[model samples]
Target chain A: MNDARRHHDMGGLEAGAIDRGEHDKAPWEKRVDALMVLLGQRKILCVDELRRGIEELGADAYERYGYYERWMASMTNILLEKKIIEVGELGARMAEIESGRREALR
Target chain B: MSRHEHTGGPAHAHGHDGYDADPTHRHPPRPDLEDTPLAYHQVMQMAVVSLLVEKGVVSADDMRAQIERMDALTPARGARLVARAWVDGGFRERLLADSKAAAAELGIDLGPIPILVMENTPETHNLVVCTLCSCYPRFLLGLPPDWYKSRSYRSRAVREPRRVLAEFGTDLDPDSRIRVHDSTADMRYMILPMRPAGTEGMSEEALARLVTRDSLIGVAVPRAG
Candidate 1:
């Protein structure tokens, strides 16, 4: 895809440029930087694994992650093994929390 | 020829994906992508890895010598703060009042976006999304999941969270309410999951274990049993 198409496909760069007061950086790129930092910190597992987590994840981490399946799973597995996640448990709690959030919105 | 499994599930013959259609079993890598050099990216990666190691947050010798290819795997700094909140009510109050200060207390400095921590009370459920995309607080949490940024999740989460939750394998009862928050502007969130019952006086590590990454993200609940 061309730069314009790529930019559009990722998410609008126009909004990013306006928001940052500079050239727009794609959302996926920012996520990549965050993952690198996490790897550096030894807080997570491997780089590829982090990318996988980004793919499988359904919620925002620092900012957001674009669809990159293989990479996200790798990250999820490593983080899961590292005890950085509570896995099946956290999902259940988030549902309960959302209930209250819905009321506030109404 | 069509491959068939004894269990009755449709299957593929020969090198057709794995038994379960898992990619890990089939066509592992494309040669072209594998042959490409990543020297420059690796160098940049090393700089980040070194920074974290120097800080002593992660040991240098414990894991691999070099930081391999990276991705946003787990929830970032935000989860840590939520864990802290689970133990210390006073700190939790401070966090909800001023996320930046609370984060600083834990040595996490979130620049620009003055982080604001939100508590998920019994009456309100908070789900964050960047309607345009996914905007999370990585300063507290580590990274977001892949599904978070998908077109379906981003679009549906704000308008129809109950539906989204069900899709994510969280089936809530009809009587239970659901709320979703779109994370926009400078404000970012780290969910304060309700303290689980039991373990009235567990140690910090034990409690931290219960405070899973998903709970802080407002997706899952703490494990009580």
Candidate 2:
């Protein structure tokens, strides 16, 4: 199915016009917009990983299609705003989770 | 249904398929680790670094110090970003459309590497494997989980993603489409899996509980039900 149809079928997403002022908007609002696309099957993604994957596919030349570092920074900011993962919490959590799993297996 | 689907060619060999059968104890040679294979500028940088070190232009102490600092660094910021993306749709969309913009929004930046987003759809599942090396989204997901960085996972994910997923308990039919994503470029990718059930009205923290680092890298499916 086409992107538009797939989007609509999944759930109507209000991917409003690409507003530059999105920079000033709250992270949660931006998240809502992104989620709409995912639910709509717009293929939620990470631009850096996508480029890396493409590059791995032997498209080193094609990898330079866009400015990746800049996009990663921007996308990261959006995710941070939602507090989905705390800035400094990953390390502790990893330790706790791993330790628990190890204990469980033992 | 057999989860292993034959896409085109038969799957490539894994790193440890016959590791025990080596008559000689020679390790495999490392692949080229140059930042850019054909870039003249990098060639010049390597030449300069070599020349400088030969002439004591830049002290080995300085180099060692820099390496030490880098080694002590943790990738928590990137992990935070991945967890956040798992919960927020707008950010996820922005991440897919433009990763740099998304990263900037979070105040973390990757100077030169371009970021890319690949989603895992029901029809087209995405699995990430570092066939050549252990390249991963360290910043977003912290250190790579043991399973993800394992030789078995790297080899199995690419050659037999359906079987691998089933091993991880994500059963998919053989006919169900599969796309293996390799994190080998200057760009990085994170999986946007289908949200699990029992998460209605759950807070981001709760949602994060379900976002395993492996799932973010597309190795394992998010737990649902």
Candidate 3:
């Protein structure tokens, strides 16, 4: 197999039948979309940068994560690389939100 | 494996029957209502929004407004263009020549990327796909559907579009040619399907009602009402 194609370069392959059933979009997904739009609108990150981040996600994670999940990962990575949002602050915020969510559920 | 189940034999149960045609639906319940813990991405999304708003890079109000602007857009915008092209050949020529200006005439801003319009005639049908990730004409046709972003479609659209179209219940004539347009980040595409016969004398608004999102994607053709 002398294949040189990248993981996300699935232009033509033996992929199976398409799933026609449309799933209900989650609110989080819309927020992720809005985040991208805002980021783009502010000239903080371009769509090309997002595409590159997605391409860098390797085969397994690319296949595993949902569409917007991959988008979140890529955007976060780009923001981190750009120094727009530091990893420590982001992790701390996520942990705080997680605990608050757990408290509410409990 | 496959991402979604192949609910075959279709007039497109999910959307085209009413979605792209009518542009109205209910979204799923918010994740907060669910008893399970927040997903990793959901947490990240919240954190990202909070950080952006706190840092003044973008306001929460502006974020909401941006989403609303996108939410307000629908396939009707593209349908109106298709219907206008159906009734006027001059408009069609202008559309195929410069889609952005044509869409602008209709008060639709197609954004920075150039979205090319491919007209479908009796001899040829055009299909749109984004193999290298979903590079769709979002501002023109609203958000790309899940199936449009599916790995199966991304892979097969350029390879076996005829079979894929058949899955959408669009069986083309044996002699008719099918052209697949793979959209990139720099350029986007949408199919201007042939006007169904016997649609004469109908107002443009009435004709626009017949254009489905699937048809605009070249998987199906609008039917005469």
The numbered model that scores best in lDDT is 3
lDDT (Cα, tens digit) per residue for candidate 1, span B53-145: 555545554333322222222454555677788788899999899888887898867655666666776666666666644567665564555
Give the TM-score of chain A, superposed on the true chain A, for all candidates in the order listed: 0.38, 0.26, 0.95
After aligning candidate 1 to the native by TM-score, how far in Å is the CA of B159 from where it should be? 1.8
How is the predicted docking of candidate 2 categorized under the CAPRI scheme?
incorrect
For candidate 1, give the lDDT. 0.51
- Give the whole-model CA lDDT for all candidates, comma-separated: 0.51, 0.47, 0.84
lDDT of 2 at B121: 65
Answer with 2 or 3, whichever has the higher DockQ.
Answer: 3
Could you tell me how far off, in angstroms, the CA of residue A23 lies in candidate 1 after the best superposition?
28
Instruction: Report the CAPRI category for model 3.
Output: medium
Task: Supply the global lDDT for candidate 3.
Answer: 0.84
- lDDT over C-alpha atoms for residue B65 of model 2: 55
lDDT of 3 by residue, B1-225 (tens): 433112111222233212332224443222232345667878898998899889999898997798788888788989999999988898899999999898888888888888899989899999999999998888878888889999999999999999999999999998999899988668888899999999889999999999999999999999898
lDDT of 1 by residue, A1-106 (tens): 4533422124322221011011111223343355545564554464334534554443442233223322344444554477555456434444444454456546
> Could you report the DockQ of all the candidates, in the order they appear?
0.03, 0.02, 0.59
Query: What residue pairs clash in candidate 3, if any at all?
Result: none
